[model samples]
Target: MFGEYSFNNSQPASAGGHPGPGAGPAPGNLPPQSPGFVGRERELAHLGHLLPDRRLITLTGVGGVGKTRLALRAAAASGPERPDGVWWVELSPLRDPGLLTATVAHTVGLADHSARSLDEELCAWMADKKLLLVLDTCEHLIAACRHLVGELLQSAPDLTVLTTSREPLGSPGEQLVEVRPLPFEGPDSDALALFRRRAVAASPPAAAAFDDPGRATIAAEVCRRLDGIPLALELAGARLRSWTLEQMAQRLGARFDVLADSDDALLPRHRTMRTAIGWSHELCEPVERLLWARLSVFTGDFDVAAARAVCAGGPLPASRVERVLAGLVAKSVVRRTEERGAGIRYRMLDTIREYGHDWLTELGEVRTVADRHAHWYLALAQAADRGWMGPGQVDWYRRMTAEHPQLRTALEQLLKCEPAAAQEMAGALWFFWFACGHVHEGRGFLERSLRSGPRTGTGYTQALWALGLTALLQGDMDAARGLGEECTRSADRLADPERELRAAYLHAVAVMMPGDSVRALTLAGPRARAGHGGRSSGPGWLLCRLATGFALCDLERFEEAAEEARGLREACAELGERWLRAYADYILAMSALGLGHHGEAARHVRAMLSNKRLLGDRFGIALGLDLLAAAVAGLGDGELAARLLGTGHAWWRTVGRPQMGGSPALTALRDEGERRARAAIGDAAYETAFLGGTAAATG
Candidate 1:
């Protein structure tokens, strides 16, 4: 979901590349390949043969049997054949099936701007593209995967899906490719090659000893004892740096024997895999084991700050976590990698994470660690909220987006044990949810927390205010009004002017959205005045001013609206906040258009568009495009205006909203722009231009 789009004649540098106009560099979403990929030539060749004929291929095997690696290799090898390239969607971080469609849509670069369902948008986007979509780690969400894959293959004839799971997806047309463990018997076996490769990298001394036939026999026995599973071999090989091959082999054999006796219920391969991980765990120092258990709380990759905050205290000191983490990485128990623009992040493989989770449960520290993780993320959300109106707004957005999975995990845990904390945390993340087009997910959290939490205090008031705003954006006026009224009552009882002002702003926006300008003005005017009387000067106060400008414009008070908008724009400029300024620009642009200042209106619209683009605010961008098209229409470029309208409509669909609420004037302007453009160009020509614009937006 996060990469640059380019046009390239040669092979793309990235994995998933979608074909663009004129055969530029393709757009793709494949993750980078793992380092030191040893073998799988036969599997790759088999995949190459199957892919051309099969639309859906499932690489099924036990955990750590190299299914994912084989899939990645096959997809990359087949990239040039498919003009749309390959897309990789990692499902390990996903917990809810409801988010599957949206996640896939985002990965494929489909913005949910239209009011259409995510599935509709995805199907439309992929209908003409020839690509491979790799769904990784699907066993946990097999049912969702089956349904989604079935829908996708039915809708897109040219699209191919490659999935890696412990079992088949069970969807129709799914070709099963059962991945077996690398062979340890032959002299030139892949398992031996992988073991030697890892051993030499882990220790130069081990590399020297491997040259001897005696040592080679020991290494072969070690591989055989571990059943030749790539993950097991690598973990075993990591110990060669500290222990002799014979020693590691003896320890692994003992551990596996103990595990086999203890858990005969598990499948043989599963028992082997868990035994290898448990052997690795036993070799770790006490502090290392403790850190591993604590680190299991994270759902995805984490940084040192997260590690220190969540995994420290209780045998693992905060100051020593970094060193212990490095040790774990060296031992192949944890993986360390550098994420683009995010510096270094650490992750444990799914199998390893499960082992750690089991240990954590045995230790009875699940609640304690979960609470710490929630608290840290709550602080992070609050910080991001504070920074949203400053220079770091975009950075904060990206950080919050990257941390979304972990935040969701935290919220789920908190909701059960500490509902009040859930309310506060969910309220704190409102800006991220709103700005990033996570309306459905955000509303769910807010509603659930509000229902379960106590109906008093600042946290509850904040939750109500946040929920009201989320509903307002979702066009649920009844829910918004109910929440707004509740927020008002709670704020008044608690004597919290800030929450009260926010409630007034919400109510005003709710009424203004439906064309009640006079009532909106009355509701917002007092709050705006109160906010400006040194009572509040944060985001809420700015929003109050924005609502006031919208009401004034809706009442046809152009001059007054322009003046208020300009003032708010200046204030936002001083505060280095673009979100509110974009709205202010929209109000100013509308006023200028109404007052017959075409050039001025165009400038304001362009400014709004630039700001929204900078913030990645798709909804704002759509509204700005509509206004810009209106300005273009007024300036006598109806053809271009029609195209822009089409582009704007496309973006609007991605946002799942037809138009921004609280401004009938703006809506009327959009309608007028469309009518004038169509009249000037004729319906046929207008339709052609509009479709062209939609194509351009999609590209």
Candidate 2:
């Protein structure tokens, strides 16, 4: 009824659709304003008054009291003051406190691939920005939320943190805003209006039933008995699909009276919300109830396929999931949203999800459901990995990014029981971690799986390769080499040639880390061609070719390297693979630079930067930006080169690395290019341009 701009009487959409904050992604996933915000005028104004001056404001309230909706709307309302934009980081689905900061980082588009602690990275990233970060549903992660919020406020002078929790986070300087339930009768806002709106939309045929003056009193009674909690009101509205307006009101009144008698321990409003939800659950069909319980295992949002895979079993077959899911949507138990690349996804409010989780625990199928959820995500990872070299490449990238939270959940879930399966999934997510800029998190999963799982097996060997890839990217040469060697030993012991070739390919990368391109070429060239029997395709094949091409360029065989890189680029093009294509562009750019084709070098370098940007690969951007600085410097654009160098410096700081991870050769080359730019532009002019670049980055 509120339409696209109204409040979601269903599930909130603050997860992926929120864009990056101004500091990261603009207006970062502050759930779409699809459902027009309803009747929070007083609370919104209060938030608006406090936002500009308060660094930390915690919206404390009972579940289902409209804290998240109010927080998002208020943040949106104060747009001019928050030039860096508002970032919504939903913490409701997280059970592990350890992942709190990482979740915040990921949600805000800080895909940091450094070894540094996430809190530190976040503080630095937000250090000079003016943005409002909304941490929704923090009751479960209160302590962690306090610590992180404190750290961020201390480090970022201009950052404002607005958190939603049942209790205050106890952080100093926090302003507590208790979001009360909507009023059923008021001049400014009335919960009865909300109920009537939703109820009318629920059953359009009997829509006038709610608006009839004779039934207005009964509708008001329904809103009052439900405590006017937005969630409860919406659930009541959905019941109109099955009952007349008067019947729904009478049922709610009876339900609340019984709930009040039974649960005096719960706050009155809490009891009302709980009783309303329980009544909804009781009214569901047995199969629908089961589906709701099983769906609690997912975090954020899930698609129809994912829901079926994780929730379907015994009595709930896959074929029936779609119909049951639609029923849930109709009931406002699950809200559907269209994600950019991922299709229609359904999400439950944290309050509703908690209710389902309680039922799941009651069903005594938590472990079973969790394992099924993990397996489903494992299969997703494997499929994405297999499709990495095909037309689905772009789709897989968006899909994996959309599903990253679930992948993390699966890795953690399996790590406690099936560590080998965990290793396999972590290894299978190579493209996500390696190319999609999750190298740091991939390292964590890979290292933990390796430590916990068996020392021998194909999955274990693949995990080694994946870990090696992360280590190399992180500039941990020793660990990369050790893992590569361990992979080789495991492959030899297992007699798996595919694993052996993968090990060789990674080992060649390790050899190249120390500026030994000659040895890298020697180790990778033959094995690379021989890898998977020289079929010369796929990630392994592409990686091997990429390595050889890099080694040739490092060896200053520019002509030969360019030829090889051209062929590799064409293959990546055919495969719709951007990650390796970016690298191929890198090789081409290097060759062009070496041959003094400055214009060609600039073109290739810019292409590489654009590709990395699409992948959200900040680490790759740091690398690519430096190359662009050089290409422009060689192209005789002194001022632009200086500015590029300064901008690249900020990115280098972000990744905690400088010019090819501190390699002396690359560092010296960068220095020479900087020197040339400085000489060409007068000292004063260069200094001004450089600062302008740094300002742009830091700003």
Candidate 3:
């Protein structure tokens, strides 16, 4: 029997963990090395040789060929050579290319303070650094990654980029490295070694059985039939706890032979990987198989509770889902791992998910399962919205962040079959979208759901309001106004005061963008008062108050705005609501600045930035940065203020909108800050400092 070995031995303790003095800012958020990583010695050496000379190296292979694992190993092996340190950015969960730069910037710890674009910031940051960036799982965002890598490599002569994907990124200097499966032949092959290791670890009693020559040959045969793909072999090896080595081999042969007979266009190894998954699927108990099929609807990892809520029904009862899910995990059909503060989550590899999805389609349960998945997430969104202002605020934010991928999948599915359900789900997700800074993705979902068809009643009205709010935040004033008007008409038709209030809130925001502070305040006051009735604390009511506060700030009623914002901030704090609290702080900061309370203004601005960062709210962060720049300008730190302004500018570009739609008050503040900065630092020095700040923030 082969004993378990540690793969982390080849690198120093600080290699991927932390940075020493000379290593620039420890590798930014690299994926943890796999404990079971095995058999990529040649690939590691190949990458080491290629990466030093080539600017871009893409590891290309079919799914489950261990491209990501091999890439990580190669990166860790070469960690000591790069003084600026290596960075890893995983793109598996990203659905929109528009957010590509922002995602990478956030991953690399870029504060994005400049008014310039995220890409510019990235280029400026990388321009003079000696670094290695490993972009894992780039197949989905290949075009975006290609363009970004092209730009960065062009600007930063010393920067090296490595990517893992099913295909090449096709950049100008990209060297493609095809990652093949582990060798299956020969007695000392890596495939057999990996199988024996995993099999023994999975079932300690099976170690003695593998010591027999005949059983060892059976295990090798099992690995060969599974195409020697690391993922497939691991799944096969996990079954050793239940089946004898020979039985597992026989079962795999029978199932794979059928699959191999078809799909000749697919590479032999690709077919083998698929068949290996199908074999595992075939060996599952009926309930486990059903659960596997239903679980395919989820786009990311999910807990047992989510599994039960979305997958349990009819033949698969909620009471039995946990046991079946555990069985699936035991069989290696589902990967189980713990998320900090989020507990254990189960996920299927994309290949396994595709196989299960096909089975789900064949079973004629796609619609049923999709609807169930949508309904489950819809309920979750409602719960999150309800709890957005209470003790569970942080938990709600975490849950929404973790479940965002699934929520998007649900919205996509719902838009096709049930537009009303889609509308409701999108509308319900308003708090998560706005508070968490998922503005781009949320807008996409809202637009798609709205385009699916006309909807009626509360769901449609709320969807209109939500869409209007998103547009307003993104600085699409015309669209916001149109949507707001539509929402108002719908609210009137339905005669719903809550809907009316929400509609007015959005409308007032659109109205305020052009600098009509008094009208905006008047427009929102009555509706907000009506909605609150002195006791309402839902997301809608909070939003209404937020609009009123904004209007007051814009009216230059400094004392009045501070009073309103302070009350709202305190209320939000009591309820543990960070989103509305952030807005309240923003208003308070502006009010403090208006009152020449520079220290208080700085305090409020810092508070706003903290909350925005916590929620991953880049748009809010940009706003906070701008306000902080104003505070610094008031404090006589001209150079720092100029840099902060540039940083804020960079983030604003990422938001895809103008700040406050070029309102008079905001423009004046920006102009005044620049004037003071230039006077204090001189124009040439100010420009240099500003550009540097932009680079640092975006970089």
Candidate 4:
């Protein structure tokens, strides 16, 4: 039942520096742009006309004025029109001016920047390439960006640069596209169009309401208040899911007065967005601002409990979190999002959230804020870990996986400030290593977190166990054995049953790294059946059994492996383990594939993928994709095989797993499997279908 997992590490050409005109966008390239490109047909055509001659074209607009989305849409639509490729460069996290050029170069896969000035090398490289470079969100680094774009234009006349900012570059040969707010006329206007789109997203039936006088008026008002900016309108409309029209009007009135700053010097409506957001924030109570500051800790949408844990304190009671959240939503300070089967959640726009973060920091509460951020994430990691190991493991992972970006951001900030806390964070995320198929990420963080602090307490014990499990997953026998032994010794001294259970599971799994299927089965079999109480039986012990069973199947011990999987399933079901069932199904799928039961294998693989996908488990979903691809290939369905493989490749890229680094044995097995499939289908046909399928998948 041991199906191997892999990820795609291919970055975009602009990011990974892969040289080939026909070479596709780098892996994990830009996510699919929203199909919400409205009223930009004229702008897009204008930009296209200028693209042939001008090497640098920039779209300048106020924040929330749809710069990034427009640029992204233009790039994707124009990618095929360009010869080299369309490369989008998002330059927001780059702070140091000196590292600006290096950041660009590193993204394009340039190694050893110390050997040459990155600017010079970048210019030289672009001179020969006919690609379109879309530099997004550049307002924060305007001067450095202006200089770089100017030099690149001078040197690489054939290359095209598309930039988005709050202001123009004001450079020679620059075709400045001054993006204005959508025109808020009747329903047909751009502003109204954007509002209708957002309203439709909130309530699909609202699409028909566009023709209604009252709804259209409100939509127009919303568009006008938001200054026809798509992001702000979307934020406004999202609140409509719960808010009434009258409430919206009242809030907008307060927002406009505050945002407009009636007595201040007159400014462009777009610039007033910041003021509008400030007004919205001011409408929030001290607790709302506090919650806003804490929400800034997340890089993506977050849950209510997370907000409560991180943002609550100082005059604010955690029990009143729901009310504060309601206030923020009422004022449109926090945007709510829905998760299937999970309740509604909230987030702040990057720009607005950053403003609140700045305010929080200025209040001399950064350390306190940082502490809350760490503490909340520690709780998050623990919950995710527990979810992964419990029933509905797949579903739990899906819910937890949705929070991956936010969790990572929290942990990163924590590691930066209190490196010692990283130990707990890493340990807490240990189940993620095997369950989500994120062995590499799990290993990297575990190693870094452990090295950051001395080996002691639960944190140290957890780290040791995590390290061993990661090694075992990657088939690093020696490292796994050593770490496993170390983990067991540490746990023994600690005398913690939970820790001991985890360490023993790792030890059992490590036995398989040395190709000892019998020993691994002997060591992990009984433990695999042992109940983990609230923890899903799918963590170390179950994963070890699955892997060992796969090894046993390869060694011709099919009956033993199958029996073990069946036995484990029964135990898991008795414990109400829904998540463990998915893993068991995956193991059975692998065994069926090995046994040449193609149809059965495909069914099991599909089940596993569906289960994991529902739970937001990207890692497991990727593995399921890989298994499905192989299963289809084994079934002689070349077309289906190619499609599954392409999807698997995309998911792998998103996960950022590298080949030939860990688990050489599993990697080789996959390579051999791919080779065998290719030999069966013929190389030419497989390549054609694979490439075509990959192209379709990316689109």
Candidate 5:
């Protein structure tokens, strides 16, 4: 309210008896202030002509390039031409991806009773209507914009979508009109005219005030530096009231560095790019502010439940995080995106979020808030792990995976600690290492957790198992053996069978010395059975079994190993999750290859590769690449196999997974593949050592 501008907050005039907000013929009153649209003549005409042919017109341009102003002009010009109304859908305040369609629906005043699809209701409302839909700031919601525009085009051909974005909306019938900067040449260039107009508006006697031709030249330079982008030019002009043109130019870089400047008294967002965001922040209610600040903790988009858990500190009730989220949407500070889902995910623009981050830092809440955010997300990851290993596993995994960016942010926050947030934050997400294919992150987190202090009970077991698995997966026999021993010994003292079983399987996986496979299998078998029987469906169950089977394959028990892997695959499918299924597939593929089932091995390996890629598993990529190379080699395409092997080895070394330590099966296959590929592509010893040796430990 403090930053509120002097605009009529009431109804506006129209040809259809629509009451004007003030004593003016224009819809919002204060006259059209037409300025005859300085230089958008061609763009306007192009949009005008296209309006008759296409329903969706997306105007794309760089920030400050007058996209919003041009869109407003278009909406104003096309208003009377529309039958139902020319409605502007301001998406700046929307942050929840899940509520994107709902935001549109609410803006258009369309009601969907019976809980029917909002799209269906909105489309139905528009079907028989002729309206101009001006959707502003749609870059963050491009997918949802495309979907909505497409639906509206199909259902209501007469309903038009005039959108402003940083990029094209990529819809079937979207007519992309790229808005370039206003011209900088000639007295009548849109750039010069915009600069002058904005200068006059800010300083009424600016012409008389700056009698020197140098002031005018400097003004032009300011406009030119900003590329004649209207918003930027206007913002630059506003500085004329306080600072000399030279001072403004001298301090320009600060726009990016020092988010807000107290000297500027413009709109909140106009104070600086940072303060414009702060202005938007100021518009939010207290609860929304909390959500916004906490949301700033995320590196990228996040789901609603993540918001509820992390941002909704005790002050803001859980029941109202969604409603508070809605308020942020209206202010255009947070945008709702549909790339995620109706689960109501939200994100801030990068520049805007940086401002929020600065504010969060200023509040001195960065550490505590970050810890809470990390803890909540860790709990979320663990919860997803439970769902991933249980009934309806695929759906649960999807929910978790969809919110991964938030989870990643949480992990990063946990890397730095506040004691209040560290323990739960570190322990809760152990399963995510395997669940999401973030083996490196998992390993790093577990090692960090273990090093921090002595954690006990379930949390300690989780960290130990996670640390051991990470080492095992990286082919770090030494670390795996040591950690596995510590874990099993600790579990023995704690009398937790699950923990002991996990430790035994991990130790077997470590396989420090020769003939360790038999011992590993012996240790892993009974616990794997007990794990398979229990409600605990995490890595301990099938991951251990897979490790044991790999050990069996190492021991030359091909038939039994293949059978064991087959059972793991079935168990994984029953779990119905992505990353785990992928792991199971990798194990079976290895087993098949050991049994000389080349074709089956190829199929399984390909499946695993696809799944790992989908899961964004950087660590898994190394193993998948190696397996894929083996399958290609089996196909008798030695040249192709060599090429793949080179790529695989290079990638494996880059990820710093330990050399298979001394496993004859894994090492021999890798060496053979590398030797074959090197014969074709010359020796590059550096490639072998690219990321080898203690990379995981260092990380």
Candidate 6:
């Protein structure tokens, strides 16, 4: 059932630079703007006029004041002016302000896996781009938002930021556009228009009903009472699903009377919104209300499967969770979005989610539900670990990417409840953290969880290995070596030979990173050949074989390395395993170049690049591109080699390190390729070709 998995980290660009104009696995998560938007002509005009000229525009308003909706509408029209691509980042789901930079970078299509601070990574990512960034719901993270927006503006001259908050971020160059609720006054008022449109949407028959002058008057009165707030109108209109206009008016009038009596301090509009929301909660079927509260466990959009898993128990049966979720969507308590491949996903507006969170707290089920959520995600992480070797690897990558916010949430839950399990989950996601370009964030979780120190278990052993791999990628050789030693001790203490083999593989890579290929060979060879893992040593064995081939090539045993890499690659191909095969291809390519088989080297690098691209392995892609450049230079395409060299460097920047882990042996080869290219083409021709690739920027 494993379908060959692939990710579109970057669209294939021309031969010179990185991925083309189209980038990332997908465009930023800017949901389609709602079609129900009505009566903001004046605001839309002001925004359109100001957006192109202003660097930062803050849409200030109260909850339910339609700031978010207004921002979306404006952003839709503002795109033509800011066309690297307009990206929207929803901040409501983010609980930790520390993640702000990384979150924005991810949304903007930069899956950075570098060792650099995320602040540096994000700005470098945007340094050469022209795009409009919409940051929604900044009220909860005012200070962080202010700092980030200020820095981004300074770093990316062409970047414009649009923010929605109750208060302005007060950045020096920020412009304020207060989004008051739609005007409630005349019959033709924006509020009345919004109310009518939504009323018709809830019950199509309401369109005909509103044709009656008396009913139209009733609608206006309802809109006037709700004080022109779009959320209040939409909630009131949803009542048309079961009630007529007159009945909606009657129920809402009495509800507001009770809400008014209950609170004298609220603004009329703010009070109207609270009354409408409270009244909607009261109107829900018991199960639907329960589902609403429980689903608050999700930090972002979730699918039916997630809903059933986390929200089902006691009064809520697993079988009924989907039905109740549908009811919530129908009642406008939840929003649903369907995109190709992503499936139908649901999320609540920030205001609604907060209300549910408060109710979840009151029910004393918060911890219980949080535990269930953590367990569900833990199971998914384990499944990902098992499935990454198969065709389903691509899907798992996308699924985990979509669930990242929830994954972070689950990590927090597990850390509080059980540190060991948290560490295991972090380690289990090695493919995601390493192969999928989330290494920076993955390192954070691994380091945090490892603070509990070494544990003697398979999961903990792998976690240590995973951390070592990340350290190596970030060019932190000392940390990587330390982690490798720690992994070896833990595995030996546990009496797990396969685990020991795995540790050996890590130690080998760490040792080789700085050009000590001989030491790497010495460390990994004994464990690999001792037959410690036997039939079960498939993974650890493959890793050691891959490391051995790498060391052999570094040692210039060209013919031996080629034979070893070729045999291992064919074996992996037969088993449908691509990760090790990709590295094997790298080894064969390097060996071919060393043995003076330039065309053979090019073919091997091409095979390696194919696999790396499929898995979205940016680091692998970087390595492959560099070798490909060397091969191309040998094959007499000096200009192309120059371009490839520049493009490979761009990809390496995204990895936060130079290619080949900065090993002296590898760097020598890289230098040779550049030298050949400059010699073959004039220095002037090579520089021009290289600059063309660099100017295209990192994907």
Instruction: Say which candidate scores most in lDDT.
Output: 6
Q: Cα lDDT of all candidates, in order?
A: 0.79, 0.79, 0.76, 0.65, 0.60, 0.80
**All candidates: TM-score:** 0.90, 0.93, 0.84, 0.65, 0.55, 0.92
Order the candidates by lDDT, highest first — what do you get? 6, 1, 2, 3, 4, 5
TM-score of 1: 0.90
The TM-score, computed over Cα atoms with residue i paired to residue i, of candidate 4 is: 0.65
Q: What residue runs in model 2 are displaced by over 4 Å at the alpha carbon? A: 1-27, 186-189, 205-207, 527-534, 695-699
In terms of lDDT, the poorest run of 10 residues in model 5 is: 2-11
Residue range 1-699, candidate 2, lDDT tens digits: 101111111111322443321132234456667463578888888887899888899988888888888887887787667666677887866778877877777665565666667788889888987878889888888889999999999999999998889999999999999899998774224697787777777888665765576777777777778778998888888888989877886777777666666736887778777888899999899998999999999988889999988998899999999999999999989888887678788989888888999999999999999999999999999998888877777677788877877888888999998999999999999877877667667887888999999888889888889999888877788888888888889877877656666777798888886889988887678554674464466566678778888889888999989988998999999877787898899899989988999899988987886676656566777677677778888877888878777777776665556775677656865886788888889889888887766655543
Ranking by TM-score: 2, 6, 1, 3, 4, 5
Per residue, candidate 6 scores C-alpha lDDT tens digits across 628-681 of 889989988898888888877776666656764566876887899999999999
* Model 4: per-residue Cα lDDT over 1-699, one tens digit each: 212222223222221222211133432134356666788878888876777777788898777888887788777766666655666666654444555665454343332111234567668766766668878778778899989988887888677888998788777878888887777876689877777777677767666657777767876776776777776776666556666655776788776776455666546664567666665566566877877776676666778877777777878888998898887776557767665544577877668878788887877787787778777778777776666555556455555555655656666776777777788888887766655544555676788888887777878888888887676555466788888788878877887656666676677667765557666655555544364322334355555556566566656665666676776667666766655566677777777877788799888877776555444445466567767777777777765576556556555443344222334444554564466558767888777766655554343
Better TM-score candidate (1, 3): 1
lDDT of 3 by residue, 444-527 (tens): 788887778576788878778877776776667888888988888998898776777777788888888777767777767745
Candidate 1: list runs displaced more than 4 Å. Answer: 1-25, 77-86, 109-131, 152-159, 211-214, 253-263, 526-528, 531-536, 660-667, 676-685
Over the stretch 148-174, how does candidate 5's per-residue lDDT look in tens digits? Answer: 788888998677888989889888767
CA-only RMSD, every prediction: 4.2, 5.0, 7.0, 9.0, 20.3, 4.1
